[model samples]
Target chain A: MAQVRNKQVLLKNYVIGFPKESDMEIVEGSITLKVPEGSSDVVLLKNLYLSCDPYMRLLMYKDTPVSLGFHYSPGSPLTAFGVSKVVESGDPNYKKDDLVWGVTKWEEYSLVPSAQILFKIDHTDVPLSYYTGILGMPGITAYGGFFELGCPKKGEKVFVSAASGAVGQLVGQFAKLTGCYVVGSAGSQEKVDILKNKLGFDEAFNYKEESNLDAALKRYFPEGIDIYFENVGGKTLDAVLLNMRSHGRIPVCGMISQYNLSQAEGVTNMAYLIYKEIKMQGFIVSQFYPLYPKFLEFILPHIREGKIAYVEDIVEGLESGPAALVGLFSGQNFGKKVLAIAPQ
Target chain B: MAQVRNKQVLLKNYVIGFPKESDMEIVEGSITLKVPEGSSDVVLLKNLYLSCDPYMRLLMYKDTPVSLGFHYSPGSPLTAFGVSKVVESGDPNYKKDDLVWGVTKWEEYSLVPSAQILFKIDHTDVPLSYYTGILGMPGITAYGGFFELGCPKKGEKVFVSAASGAVGQLVGQFAKLTGCYVVGSAGSQEKVDILKNKLGFDEAFNYKEESNLDAALKRYFPEGIDIYFENVGGKTLDAVLLNMRSHGRIPVCGMISQYNLSQAEGVTNMAYLIYKEIKMQGFIVSQFYPLYPKFLEFILPHIREGKIAYVEDIVEGLESGPAALVGLFSGQNFGKKVLAIAPQ
Candidate 1:
């Protein structure tokens, strides 16, 4: 096996508040293009499209008190979900040249345990990058949070925060497919338009344009919201609390707004939970991994038939990985943030 | 039919902040001892023991934006749950001389709709006043929120706030009976003693005495709480959020601490719900009313065997009703606050 220069994105230091491009460094590292001999269940992968998710920011912190099992050392390559081509496999299930999507480092080529790979990308009819957005973690996240946790009913008033982003866009479309009247809040007019016009959201608003989120919710949902797919959290969650109907359900997917803050915003309207008999539940998409097969079956047809739509803010090269990941916090990316490390 | 003088506790006005004895006035009114002719579903009740409940405070507010249906007009007698004797009945379910427990007025005699009465008090071996505490609305509230919502498993760690109050005490006992390791938080040393010594809770603490509730929770629940029966919300809820285990359940029965505040304290630790994948649900006892027959069957044996215990702070006369109701907010009463308006 020949030694090759591997381009990698390494965490420069533990991120304190909001993550920045400077917090991650692009460097050259050397690795043999082969898995070690007798290394059972190991797979050699050439990383392709890497997911730039909000949860990745949590890994940038040193010894994150809140545990999701992914932590980055000061000089280690940043880890993420990506579409990869298997170069070699010690696992019997995967063969060389098989396409896969799962947990992999932000590097040109690296060896990973087979268990880290979620699934073999069998259906390659859609774009390979869709695996990082519509067919992978974010896809499962929206499916699990919206259908499993939310339990939305037809004609129900549903509100989604960060409604133009990766999981949010899918959730909005799912709600609509379920016959729910969906409303979404986004940061920009362009994102708002994508949510309403492109994603089929019944209503969409630019949260930045509204001074009072509570008033905006009331304006959109006069009868009160029956379900809220929470992504942004903080003040938006606070406002949503006030406008929730009796027996309302809040499926907290991600708190993207609070993740970067040293002190998360205080939610004051919690008493409404008691007043309205609300069910506010938080869930991680990994908990719903068992349902992924069923989810894919349900979503793949929609994607192929052009019934469901996905948007990707694709940045090319492993060098742009740091900037693309950081851009999520600032709302610089339009939809599913992805970094194209290599051509498929 | 002869008319009798009925002593009534009337709301003086819509309560703004914390309810005071002055907010309610004891007035004398007259009602005939007989049911009016051609009155369908009407029952004349000779009120016995009246329950002093936290939800009553919510009703005292004029045109409460949050609808629980019970409302108080300044000139009318305040309505509540009370053990009453059926003086006369026009409904088949309730008959003259039958004892019952349900929604009644804060007066000596009340002519009410038969539908308002919850159930006929069948078991007479126990004290009639038990219907106002251990055998009434508070009883089923503890049953539903704990067993149905909390779903505590054997050996699970359970925490109850306002542990000496009507619902909290019963919840603590039920959790213990379910083979859970239970801890309770009360307002005073007396209530704490009642929770630990009398109610068989594994541990008890006086929340008022502990300045740092989070530290106190950490001290008691080192492994973290599996279930928190939320009664007094605000700061206590904030502390509990920090000390909850992954997949913890919080059944929010009441927010007594928040009810009095013009601006309820902001719960800054709500993000814990997402981090820990917690389910925080709020519910009204009324939603679980249909399960009352099954509840009584479950609880009656425990009562007869002396396996369960309840403490009641009984105040004599309708004149003391105002003070007894106000005492709840101040944590003045030692146990379940009940006003003995008329002798059994």
Candidate 2:
């Protein structure tokens, strides 16, 4: 076994409010480039791309009840989903130099338990960094939340909030594939333009510029929304509630807007659920992972044929990780934010 | 044709804010004793009993976007579901003196269209007024909202707001019948007693007495609520959001507390839906009407066997109707409120 320098991002302390760059410290440490002897279920990996997801903000809070089966502690490297290449393996499923994507730490080299690896990377024709985004968690999130929970019918009206982000962009495209009239709301005019001109959304509006979200939603969905993929909660959810048609479906994927708030905003229009016979359901993408093979089979062709497009906002080095992660809460990331550490 | 005096409850004007008894006026109108000569689809009915349900308050609002298929106009009679005697009928479904329950006016005599009649009273073993409460619309509302939407499994923890009200009482009973641990909340100590001691609820609490609804819910459902049958929304609903178990289901029937408010209270705990992967659905009982016969088959036996019981707060005459209807908003009614006009 040999020691190598492992540059890591570690949580300095528990975050109380909006996180700043100072909350996380980039530390250089050494690690043996091998799994511990007799640890048959451990594999050593060189972390490639680390995904900066809105869900990571939740982990920074002290004793946050909600967890995605992972927890972060002060003085330890923060763990997240990433694309990595195996440096050594004690498990037969993976070998040295094998590419994979799964839950890994925000460091140069990680000794991950074999069970923590989500999948062996089989397709590499496209950008391997995609494993941290469009080809990974966010992709499955859009598929499960939209198709499974949303159940959009042809010609139905669809609305997506935070539509330029990792999950929302794909959801809009999927809605269009179902022949729905899709409209999306993003914080910036640039993101709104990408939703309309690039993603093929029928209409896109900058939510930040809209004084009255309800009126804006009403204008976009004159006939009322049949499906709403709720990403940014709070005011956006309240507005969408009023615009939902009879038997409308709302699949709540993420509420990034509410995540960092001291006190989450109140939604006053929830009574609309009964008036319109609406179904508002919330789900985690991991619950639908069994469908990943089929998801890949479904989305791969669209990607190759140019029917579907994905965007990633990549930042280099592990040291840039904290800022990239923090930027997600402020709508600073243009698309999927990925920290490229050891890019393949 | 002979003309008869018809005493009716007429709306003085469309209501604003909390409805007051003064908003309705008692008027003596006249109706023909017989169905119109060539009006084959018409049926003249002598009104028997009128049900005072929470949903009726929604119709009192001026130009409410949602309605139960009928409206109340100023100086005209208010319409509601009532049991009546078919004095004269041109439709073959009924003959003179046939007993029925359906949408009828708040009056001594009502000339109703045949299509508006809901059902011909078949089982005479139960009280005819039961047609207005346990055996009629509210019956189906509780059945549909709880069994269909709540989807309680054995040993699941269930919570019902408006516990001793028409629908909530029945929902608690149904949850208990399904082998679930059921808790209920009401406005007064008496209603809470009726819930735990008489209705077979595992525990009951007076919501009005509980300063911290979240703490109250935690005390009763320490393991967390698996199903919440939402009747009284607002604060109770907000609190329930924090105490829900993963994959919890909230079936929205009516938000009585919210309907009267100029500005409905905001629910700030909606983010829990995503964290817990909960399903909060709103529905009208009409969607479950097709399952009515099966519902009757399931409940009637329990009622006959003394395994299930229903309580009603009855007031005499159409004159007491306005007061009784207004009382529901204040939690003045003990159980299901019914106005007995002409008893069978």
Q: What is the lDDT for A304 in model 1?
A: 88
How high is the TM-score of chain A in each model?
Answer: 0.98, 0.99
Q: Write down the lDDT that model 1 would get.
A: 0.91
User: How much RMSD separates candidate 2 from the native structure?
Assistant: 1.2
Docking class of 2: high
Worst 10 residues of 1 chain A by lDDT: A61-70
lDDT of 1 at A294: 98
Off by over 4 Å in 1: B63-65
Q: Quick one: best DockQ, which candidate?
A: 2
Model 1 Cα shift for residue A137 (angstroms): 0.8
